[model samples]
Target: MSDFNSSVNLTMTINGVPRVIACNPADMLCDVLRSAGYTEVKKGCDTGNCGVCTVWLDGVPVPSCSVFAGRAEGREITTVRGVEKEATEFAQFLVAQGADQCGYCTPGFTMMVLALKRELKSPTETEIRHYLSGNLCRCSGYEGHLRAIIKYLEASHE
Candidate 1:
């Protein structure tokens, strides 16, 4: 029998860097990443209702809080920091539209946006809203975020 509470080492490619991190089998990926100093992975609704702890798991956006750390072994994970250039560019639009409020959900939101940009060549407004439905922002009331995302997508295509 194996002890699930025992800590184990997992080698996961994080932000394009391979890192061996120690975590319990039961530990959530978000918690482990935060402990490993990836504070960008915020601790939100642990039930995966909130996308505040979103990260790229094998190039797909997933709620880290719902993922087991052990499952990430040998997998590629990309945080908002991994795509800093794109994140920064989007952030400018966010700021310009006054959508970068509180900044707690920015990282996860940015990750989703980056993925959306890569996945959708020319997403419609409905597609954009549908893609970002998982992420919630109380400060901006979503209007600002929608405006910023639309503007960012437009500027990026220009």
Candidate 2:
């Protein structure tokens, strides 16, 4: 259609399923997911710094808020709600390590951790810390977060 940007059929594999959505071309992936009833995708800065809108775009962690819906026409968006297993496991680790305080940042941390785990499966504290520099935590002072992720990395491999 000539007015493709206004109303287009976009297709993407979200989490583990393929979905075709009708939306505006300029809509950010974060809004699309949230509008599609995936509130777990989150909406933070919407600029990419907060990392609160993090999601796996084509298997790589990305801030959905900064991504255009048109760009994800054929990509995959893995939100926390869809990746419950990994999120839950990470949540368990967060609890075990006493990482969670307010809990607003837990999902972002979980998504990032899962991505890191998939890549390294086991990373040192330094590596984990360096990798997570983008995500901001208001509670726990990152000490507990670091401990949990490291522990999760260690246990996920065991």
Candidate 3:
């Protein structure tokens, strides 16, 4: 294929299902994933400043927009939909705590929190806040999210 029309074929596992996608080598993972139907991977600040396009790449939380689709080949990609159970729980917690106001940034926040939970046993409030620093929530303040994370952590231990 000519350089201008070069399309790379990528085989990556998304949300527990293996998917193959063909796209330009320079296409960002966020665009590629959304095109492939994983709309849950929201596209906010495409510059990676807003963590709305967060996804778990090989079990590590990363901003999809900053990653190239070609780099994701042979990797495991987990969008918010992949962790339905956890995301749902986080959503419920957010609702209960009134943390889900605006809701646009919730998915990214949830994904980061889920990754934190998976990596840490019982993270402190400070740790949680520090870990989720990349995500921005302009509507509701972070108190509710902090409460929800603490509650979730407590419940997990019970």
TM-score of each: 0.96, 0.91, 0.94
The positional error of residue 33 in candidate 3, measured at the CA in angstroms, is 0.6
Please report the candidate that would top TM-score against the real structure: 1
Off by over 4 Å in 1: none
Candidate 3 residue spans exceeding 4 A from truth:
1-5
Whole-model Cα lDDT of every candidate shown, in order: 0.91, 0.82, 0.87
In model 3, the worst 10-residue window by lDDT is: 1-10
How far is 156's C-alpha from truth in model 1 (Å)?
Answer: 1.4
lDDT of 1 by residue, 22-51 (tens): 889689999999999999889778899889
Of candidates 3 and 2, the better by TM-score:
3
Which scores better on TM-score, 1 or 3?
Answer: 1
